[model samples]
Target: MADERATTVAGNDAEDLSFALSCLAAGAITPEELKGWIQLALEQSRELPARVFELFAPGLANALVPGWRGLIGTWPGTSLSAAEGRAVAGIAHARFPELQPGGAGAPDRAAASAALRESPAIRDRFARVFPSIRVPDEGEAGVGCADAAESGAGAEPDPAPIWWLAGAEDSPLAPANAQRIFDDRRTAGDLTTMLESDAGSTLVLVTNRARVMIMLTGLGGESGHATDPLADGLSGGFLLDNGQEDEYRDRDTVALPRALAVIDHILTHSAPPAQGWSVEVEG
Candidate 1:
C-alpha cells in the first residue's frame, strides 16, 4: 500500500511538473507561477531531487533559469550522497557562473562550516533547528551573562530550543495581503511581544525569493498570547525543542534547516540584502 501510494504521488508530481514546464515554455505562466508549482511538486515527493537531476541532465541548461535555482540550491543533502550533492552544486555553479572561486558564490565548504561553528547567529539558528547538534561548550555562547551565572550558581540546564518555519505563498495569499499582514501595527506588535517573551525566539523573513516568503519561529509562545501561525495565510511546522522526528510536509517545514544553511551560505558568499529579504533575530 505504501509503495502504491508513493507511486501515485510520484505520478501526480510528474504531471504537475510537466504542466508547469509546458506553461512556462509557452509563456502562459510566469516564472513565479512555475516556481510555486515546482515547490508544490517538491513538497509531494522525497524522490524529487534525483528525479530532477535525471530529468534535467539531458538539458542541464534548463537548470540555469532563475526560477529553478531555489529548487536546485535547496535540494536536501540527505536525499543525495556527498558526490551527488557536489554534482548538484556544480550544476548550480554553472548556472550562476558567479559561484566560481572569487566570484559572488565563492564561500568554500570550510568557511561555511566555520561560520556554522563560530558565528553566534548561525550557531543559534542551528541549535534551534537541530538540537542534537548543540553541545554544552559551544551552546553557551548565546547565553546571557546572568543566565550563565545562574546556571553556574544552581539552576538546571536550559531546555532545548524549538524552531519553526513560517512561510507565505502568492497563491493562497496575494502580495498585497502579505504586505498588509507585515505592515499591520497589531501584527508587528504581536511579533514583538512574542520575541520579548522568549529569549530564544528568532524570525527571519524571506521576501525576494520569487513569490515565496519564509520566516523562522523560535521559542516564544506565552500562555494566552500565542502568535497566530496563519496570520499571513502562511503554513508552518517546527523542529521540537526536545529533538523529535519531523514528518516532512510542505517545503517550509521540510526545508527549514537547508533553507537556513542556504541563506547563511548566500550571506557569507554574496553581497548585501539584494535578494529582497531581511532577517530579524531576537534574544
Candidate 2:
C-alpha cells in the first residue's frame, strides 16, 4: 500500500514537472530560468531527475511504467486558451511529433473545421467512433441546399452539414429551423412536434475532425434539461462558470453537453451495442 502511494505521488510530481517544462518550451517562461529551475530541481531531489528525463525524453517513462497511458481525459473540445493551447502543442509537437492540438492561432483549426463541415472522411469517422446516433445519408456528391433544389430530387430541405454529422434531412425542424432557434430565439413548429412526442433534444458536436450528434429529449419540459449518455460519459467537457451567460463562454455549453450525454448513454448503455462500434474503456 505504501509503495503504491509513493508511486502515485511520484507520478503526480512528474506530471507537474512535465507541464512546467512544456510551458517553458512554449516560451511561456524563459528558457534560461527554466534551465536553472530544472537544475535546482534535479540537484535537490532523487526522483525528480528521473522524472524530468521521463517527461522530456520520449519512450523512457513508458518503459519505466509499463502499461501506462498518458493523461486519461480530453478537455471539453479544446477549451485551452491560446497560451495554454500553445504550451500543450509545444509538448505534443516535441514528444509525439504527429499530434497538433488546435487553437486560435492555428491555421489548421480553421482549415480542418471548414473541411470537416463538408468532408465525408469526417462523417465516416463519426460513424465509427459513435454509432448509436443515425448518420445522415449523404446526397449524391453531397451537393448543398443551393444545388439540391436545382437537381430536383427531394423537395424537403436537408440539414446543413457541420463538423460532426448530426441532424436530419426533411424533419419539420430542419437546419433552417435550427438557425431560427439560435438566431430568432424560438423553437420551430416541427421541433414542437418532437417535444410533444417526448423525443430528445436535437444535439450537435463540432470538432476540427468531424461533427457528432445525438438528440436530447424533454427540452419542452419545465426543467428544460435533456440527457444523452455518450456525452455524459465523456471524462470532461466545456463548461460555463458564470451561469453560462458570459461572452467568453462557448454557447455550445448550453445545448451541446446534455445532448452529448444522452448520445453517450445511448451508445454505451444501449442494448446489444451498435455494430462496428465499441464502448470506450474506463480509465
Candidate 3:
C-alpha cells in the first residue's frame, strides 16, 4: 500500500485508507486486520472496487489474480455473490503480500492441457455444422443462408482459434453475464448452447494464485436480504465515533471488531489448496 493512494468514493477518505495502509505496512494491523477494515468499507457502502476503491493494498499483489473473477455483478449481488468474495479478498491481499497464505500463481497445467487436448472436439463440433454452412452464391443473396458465423461463410471465424494461434491481444471477458458450463456427453453441441444461455452454470477455473479468493460463497440468500449472511452487524455498518456523538466513547474499539465475523467467514471457508491450478473448485 502506498503512502499516496488514489481517492475513494466509499465515504472512507484517502487519508484514512492511507493510514490503514500505513498501519498495515508497519505491522500495526495484520493482513486480516486490514481485510476486516476493507470488507467493512465494501459491505456498508456496497461498492465495487472497480467503481469505488482503486488501490491494491501493500503495493502490488501478484500480477493481478487472473481469470473468471466475476460476472453479472452489482451492489446487491453480494448476496451469495462469488464476485464480491473474490473482490474483497483480492483487494485486501494485494495490500499485504508479505505473508499471503500462497506463494505463487499458475494454471492447472494438467487440467488446462486436458482442456486444450479437446481441441479436436472443436473440429467434431463443426463437422455437422459445416455441412450446413452454406456460402451464399457470390452474386445471389441467400437471405436464409446460414453463413460462416452461423457456420463459416462470413467475415469472422470461431474466436477460440485466435486465442491459441495468435495469442490473446487481451484477457478473456469478465464481469460478463454469468455463464453456465455443462460438462456432459452431448459433447460440442451441448456446450455451444450452454455458453449462449442467460442462466448460470458453474464450470470455474481455479488457480493457486497468491491473491486469495474467498471460496466460501452462496451462504447468503438469493433475494439479497432476508437470508443475508452478513445481516447482523454488517448490514448496517457504523461510522467511527470521530467525536460525532461528543460522548467521548471509543467507537472503533467496538465497531472495528464487528468486521471480524466477515473476515472470519472468509477465512473459515477459504481453502485454496495446493499451489497449482484445477478446472473446478475443490469440493
Candidate 4:
C-alpha cells in the first residue's frame, strides 16, 4: 500500500521543497502567487485537494520551471469540461507522449489513483515525505479546491492563507494565531515588541512581521522607512546567516533576484525564524 502513492508527477527532494518554501516565506513569491500556483494545479487535477498539490504545488511549479502551466493548469469548477479534458490530454500527449491514452504507458486517472481517490486516510501516505506539513482532510469528492471554494469554468480558486511565519520556537505562529496578520503588513504593536525601537524611526526594523517586503522601493527617510523591511529585494524581507545552513547569497549590485534564489537554495528548514535570532533594529 505504501508503494502505491509514489505518484511522481514531479520530484520531491527535501532541499527543493525547502527552497520553494524559502522563496515563499522570504517575500520572493507573494502568497497570492503561491495560491495561484495551487489553484492552477487543482483546476486541472480534480484528484487534487490531495496534499500532493495542495501543499506541494509551489515547489512543483518552481521545479517544473517552464512546462508547469500546461502541466497543471485546468478549468475550475464542478465538472471537467470535454474541452478541458482534451486540453489536459493534449498536454500529456505532448510531454509524456507514451503515458497518454493509446500509448505505451497510458493509465487513466481512475486507474492511477484508484487507491487514493476515496481513501479516508490520505494524509498517511505523504507523512514520511513531508513531516510538519499540515494535511487537509480527505474532502468530499468533486470538492473544488482544498483551500477555497469552486469557481466558474476556466476560473481560478480563491486565495487561501498559507506559509506560516516563524515567530520564535516558543511562540511559533500557531495555526489560529498566524492568520491574524493576514498579509505581511506588520502592526505597530509588533514593531515595538520585535525591535525595541532604536533606528531612524526611519528604518524601524519592522522585523519580518511586515505583510510583504518593501525591497528598497522607496528607500528614503522622507516617506517610507518605518514600514520597510531590512532586506532590499522586491516584496522586501531580510536574510540571516544562521550558521547552520550553507549560505548562497549574492554580493554584487544586481542582487534581488539572486538574493531570492539564494533564499530558495539556502533555507533548509523552510519554516520559522532560526535559533539565536534575537530581533534587533539595524540602523
lDDT of each: 0.31, 0.30, 0.26, 0.28
Candidate 3 C-alpha lDDT tens digits along 1-92: 11112224244334344434433333323444444456445534454346224332424222222211221122221131233223223322
lDDT by residue (tens digit), candidate 4, 20-74: 3332332224343344333333332345424444333434534433333334353
Descending-lDDT candidate ranking: 1, 2, 4, 3
lDDT of 1 at 92: 28
Residues 139-165, model 1: lDDT tens digits: 332223223443475355354332222
Candidate 3 regions with alpha-carbon error over 4 angstroms: 1-12, 46-283
Stretches of candidate 4 above 4 Å error? 1-106, 117-125, 140-157, 160-283
Root-mean-square deviation of every model: 19.4, 19.1, 23.9, 18.3
Whose lDDT is higher: candidate 1's or candidate 4's?
1
Model 2 has an lDDT value of: 0.30
- Model 4 reaches what TM-score against the true structure? 0.21
Q: Per-prediction TM-score, please?
A: 0.22, 0.19, 0.20, 0.21
Clash pairs of candidate 4?
166-272, 184-210, 184-211, 185-211, 213-235, 213-236
Clashing pairs in 1: none
lDDT of 4 at 247: 22
- In terms of lDDT, the best-performing candidate is 1
Clashes of each: 0, 25, 8, 6
